[model samples]
Target: MAYESSVPYRAGTEGYTSFRIPAVVRARSGHLLAFAEGRVSSAADSGTIDLVLKRSADAGRTWGPLQVVARNGTGTAGNPAPVVLDSGRVLLLQVRNAADATEDRIRRGHVPPADGRRIWLQHSDDDGASWSPPREITGQAKLPHWRWYATGPGHALQLRHGPYAGRLLVPANHSTPPTDPQDSGAEPRYNGGHALLSDDDGATWRIGYTDSDSDTDTGRSVAPNETTAAELPDGSVYLNARNEAAAAWQRVDAVSTDGGEHLVRPFRPQAGLSGPAVQGSALHLGDRGALLFSGPAHPSARALMTLRTSRDGGLTWRTAHTVGGLPAAYSDLVRLDRDTVGLLYETGDFSAYSTITFRRIPVEEPT
Candidate 1:
């Protein structure tokens, strides 16, 4: 099915500058809000990276003005995952890079302060119109002593029709060590990749999966990139990850049936089209178990920023269609109704951070 693309979303100067790493969700009130890392100015202070937002009132038919949600210089106001809590409030779990402003640690692998790039949450009482002050997920405020840096890719979801009904599960990306031996420590090699779960919405978190003890044993840290998740029919939570070992292109899977309590093994590679640079969102579309992914559809080279659909979970995929003609990075998708799908991606030259593009994608049944 060839879905026609519409130019409903675009980046603005203030909050939409060179937008990259996008996350979108249809709020409880049928409102669609797309969030991205907004680059405001070109100056050093401009280097301050923040999470900007755009709202779509008419089912993604169009978008509203841009607004800033979170910011930290060159340090990235990374990806955000929105989950309408059991209490009807919308809570966003996001990553913030505090040390991104320092010129000294640009490329030298300056170990991010303990809490270098940390996870925080912003709650909205009025359907994203106004948000409360950002609060760090974990209250341990010693900063550098926090030890963990860069934790996110959080997709908070509630268990539907399951034993754990109301409990909120936040599958977030984190840099940590593994617990089980059978599990692969592929993350440590690449410095990170793991998921953390929070029972009390975004208040407290527990490690779902991580690397093994020995560094040499763990080949690559499978950083779960801009990944979205879904609960399988059997009550297992399947997390789609962009393993750094696979160059962030290949999609990895983590399964936890008892909610997000503990993940079994690390992950295995699927045979579809992930390459050197791929970041995506995986959605369980319909009855055929259709899994739709939005990411850099770089089959060989990072060229096509596209959307691909698979009849089976992640086994096989049909030829994808590009959302925007240019380079598309860190794309996200939401199910408007069963048939309609809304997509948001960072468009423009990812190499130089030129511009961010957002759009409305209408999915249709293949003829």
Candidate 2:
């Protein structure tokens, strides 16, 4: 199937040097919201960054002017994880840190508690026009021992079935202090995946299934980072994450039967899916019993943006279509309508950070 693509946030435009970490969600009113991290000076991950967004009224054919959702002055505000509530309210979860505090410093526990990574929540009632002030939720969402924190950087999940219906689940990752006091916490083995659960809309949040176990004796472990979530037909939660440590595959996955409170299936390397160690997105096609995943197809490089379909609840996958063959990085999926799906991803000619583009694809084509 052919895809119709357009660049909504391009590098060296709109007073920003680069844009990365693309996330998208379809508002309750049928508006498509696309978000990205607008880097001020350079394409570096750290430094001054702002969470910006754009709205599309008619699918993704065109986008409105850019809107600054949240800015931290000289600090960094990114990792947008947006979800639309049943009441037509949009809640976004993001992480903030000081401009000078890089991931390395935070992972090594060199940054002070006040300067370390923190989580915040914001809401919008009038679609994507305006947003409320960000409320700090680090105390409730993050553990003190965990460092190097990040939200989904994509669309969050809201359970629509089972006893836990209406519950909000945010896929997150964090690095813990090394078990060996002498060892550095910056090691990839310390990275793990978790979920943030909120029962009452965005009023409160609690930590869910913490997957930080690593066996040093056998050198076998699952260190999941940059995670994504999808709901299966049986009302179970499925999580797919990027493996931070050396593993047989680039992705790891787990399943939760009781909403997002606990994981029934532990984190393990996922087979039949190949990609670079990068953030990916997952979407369940309503009651179709089909799950869709989006990420780069290359195993060693962040290129060849591709989409895969899984019929057996993410147990196996088959390549459905390649969105683009150019340099691509992170991506997110949103159901635009009953027959169409929208994708917001990082792709460009020279580098993946050059532009955050949106593509519209037929939902039936992937099934």
Candidate 3:
């Protein structure tokens, strides 16, 4: 099969002025769900953004109309991180903030009650048809010191091995040192990443693991932000994170064996895989038992959307193909079948945020 593309979101349409942060997932019901941040005001990250979705029942040839699954009015309700249980139920984890609080205010520790950046969740028992109202889980999922926090801008995962086989892992990120004691006049940098574990199928949540500043000592800082995850055969959870530390923000990888509470080893940079400080995703292709990562490959730019494969469970990766030389940014990978995969991302000719799109890729090895 060839790679076919579709535009599901665009600037100035359907009451939304722009859209960004695309995430896709295939439910057990054999339906494709595409999600994006419907920025109702402008292309900026902050504003009245909602978690919007579209469903594709016929593989990838077509998609349903736009539906607002989660919204917070003028407030922020975005970064859709969805996971499908083995029971065919889809659970979504997302972040929310007050209408007046911008990213800057939250990262600086100037937070407000019931209005600060917090975590919320919703579930759809009927595939992608209807969603339950969002319920906050910030008390259990978020720490008191964490300010700028967000769930997977991509997708969550389901453990397939060990005692945590049925657990749901929500890849997430947050900034640390909620206070700037030194009075440094700079933007608050996201320090690391963590995973929220749901053992009872999205009922209760807890922090699995937190990436620390130990890796940042490598010449420059290394903040693991906007993470992606996959499970290995040995029951280890692998995280591919966006290093938003310096100009050359390379990607990093880590693994956890104990339900994401502790790391087997500190994060190591995936020097070969590169991209701008942006979100990406990872998917475990069944049958072949290989891992696939999707994101921009350019060092200083966010174009040249690249697809990579790892046979050894994320230890190393090789470029399988470049989706295109088009302007692309954030992307998420989803398995359509044993041999068919899908990529939902932001792509356009001039700007990456101009459109949120979808594409189907051949998942088998390239000859």
Candidate 4:
């Protein structure tokens, strides 16, 4: 059977104007939260991307109005992913650009002070109605670094059995020390991705394995983008990371036996949905035995047309099934119980019609 979907949430600027690029999650209180990088213009202003958040309480059946989590004057404020702390508290994770604080100093090139890349947290004690003050958890204040963003189309899962058993796992890309200019070519250059584990719920954090400087094998420098982790029954971690090598990004799976202390080198010709310069998601669903990979199945994959599923732990994949008729990319999937799976994707065309939308499907259905 094909995957079924519904558009429970969508946001437009002034008059149905699309400003989309989002991340989704299922809160502990059974509410659905979809967050996106609300852009004022079509292109990257790098200074004005805000975190636009919306919620659904009725299991993706309907949604609430759009709410602003954070905003930068002209810089970006995004990487909207949600993590339900062990204490049952829901934390919204995001990165905000400190525009006014760094614009002039960075422009003057006076050693280019790192643009503010602070990690912020918004806590919802009573569901999504109201939130606590956004706190900067990245303690790189003294450093000249400007950004500490985590653009996780991937959801954060808590470590179950280990020394750091209670810590939250978050995957992110480093925006500091922007690519080396001396080495330039047709290749793509950017900061690598890493993980941050929080012990005191959302109060504090300690970072985990960061990516290597570069990978010549993949033809470009290697770095992690959206990385999702699942704890096996034996407690070993299965990490599926979005690898950006060359210009295109592909999903690669790695296994960590020592509780994420280290991961084996990921296998190649990676087994999930990917395309040239595109993003995909790999989620552990249905009692830890099933995996849901959602993205463009073809290299030319565009829109929200393709989604694939693998039941036996990424060893093989069935043919892709379309979730929505729209151009879908940057999606998140999580099992909403046993049989239900919740999804949120950007809907619309290349130039316009952007919206962070929500949909759902069953676990036993065919891909």
- Best model number under TM-score: 2
Ranked by lDDT, top first: 2, 3, 4, 1
Name the runs in model 2 displaced over 4 angstroms. Answer: 184-189, 213-219, 365-367
Per-model TM-score, in order, reads 0.79, 0.97, 0.94, 0.81
TM-score of 1: 0.79
Query: Candidate 4 on 1-367: residue-level lDDT in tens?
Result: 5544555444445422345555676777888777777666543435467777778878877778878777656666777767776666778777766545332333233322335556667888766667787887667312344333454645677777766577677766653433455533223334456667666676677666566334445554455556666666556666666665544446555666665555555423454445534556667763546667776554655654455767666667765456655566667776677778777766665622355556667666443
Residue 100, model 3: lDDT of 77
Q: Report model 4's TM-score to 2 decimal places.
A: 0.81
lDDT of 3 by residue, 186-235 (tens): 56675778889888998898898887553433564567888999888778
Best model per lDDT = 2
Error of 2 at 360 (Å): 0.4
State the RMSD for candidate 2: 1.5
Q: What is the lDDT of residue 356 in candidate 4?
A: 55
lDDT of 1 by residue, 128-242 (tens): 8889898876543112322334433434576664776666665554334333445332323333344556567666656554532225455543445434567665566666766
Residue 117, model 1: lDDT of 54
